[model samples]
Target: MEHKIKNKVEEPFSFKKRLESFRYAFKGFVWLFRFEHNSRIHLFSLIAVTIAGFFFQISKEEWALLFIVCGFVFAAEAFNSSIEFLADEVSLEKRDKIGKSKDLAATGVLIAAFTALIIGLIIFVPKIISLLN
Candidate 1:
């Protein structure tokens, strides 16, 4: 017996759909801060970095680099959180494979955070040494 598959029609693009997508993304951004502990940590780091940038009077180019790395870290954290939530939904039981998946996702966030830290030190350490001298 052959099975007939029904083809789904694609919907035409609309401005309304684009607006809805932005709304959904904004909601997810709020949810990340509300439910994700590490996001809050990132927020604190962001604020601190902003303050330091101002105190040091970083050049426009340095500001751009800082913004890029900070954004990268947040993006990594968001991706890691989504993977964790999906893995949990798949199975609440302690499965080895699921645990490994979560670990791998977390490693992305770790790498991003570490890179940001290095950038911060590079930008600030020389200024600090000069200030002390």
Candidate 2:
């Protein structure tokens, strides 16, 4: 005798399920902050920038740009981390395709970081020069 199995479809998320998902996301963020080295670095940089923004009395527009760039870099890094994690989990072995995907994600993060660095230099150089002058 042969047995047939039926496939069950998952229902859409309800409000409670959505809340639980948000809670899980928050927990993931906390876990990342606590354990991820790059996340720690980004957190430190974010704090430093916040302090500098306040201390330097950076203009509103400059502050906006600084925060935007900072957010972009950190978000890209987080995305890179997620991609690498998924790739590693999906393939325990060092597959070339997975490796390339991870590398591309890392490259994206690097590009964002480098762009942020340039923006920081542009924003801060004149302020530093003025201080010296």
Candidate 3:
């Protein structure tokens, strides 16, 4: 026999609900930084880069690029963490496919971080070498 499932009532959109969504997103952001070790490492790198940018007095364009890349790295890290959490929730078994999924998620973070590093070096290296002169 086929079973039918009842759908819950859909609530109407309101300004209050919109604000609550932002609150939930902020909570998740805090939780990610608090609970994830890799997130902390990224946070450290972000801080270091921001200090270097100020010390070097990076151009406005450079500041924009730095902000974009840093945001990308953080977003990638958050996505990877989410995938890991969801995978664990779905199954605790040592499955090959699950392992592969986690690895792929991590690879995304790695690529984002590496790209950010290259951009940072391109922007900062010349400034540093010139200061040495």
* Top-TM-score structure, candidate number: 1
Per-candidate Cα lDDT values, in order, are 0.91, 0.82, 0.91
Q: Give the alpha carbon lDDT tens digit for every residue of 1-133 in model 1.
A: 1232322234567899889999998888998899999999999999999999999999999999999999999999889888988999999999999999999999999999999999999999999999999
Question: In candidate 3, which residue ranges exceed 4 Å CA deviation?
Answer: 1-11
- How do the predictions measure up, each by TM-score? 0.90, 0.82, 0.89
Q: Which model is ahead, 1 or 3, in terms of TM-score?
A: 1
Off by over 4 Å in 1: 1-9
TM-score, candidate 3, is 0.89
> Which scores better on TM-score, 2 or 3?
3
- Candidate 2 lDDT tens digits, 10-67: 3654899789989987877776776678778877877887887787799999998988
Show the colliding residue pairs in model 3.
Answer: none
Tens-place lDDT per residue, model 3, 69-125, is 999999998889899999999899999999999999999999999999999999999
**Model 2, TM vs. native:** 0.82
Ranking by TM-score: 1, 3, 2
Q: By summed lDDT, which 10 consecutive residues of candidate 2 come out lowest?
A: 1-10
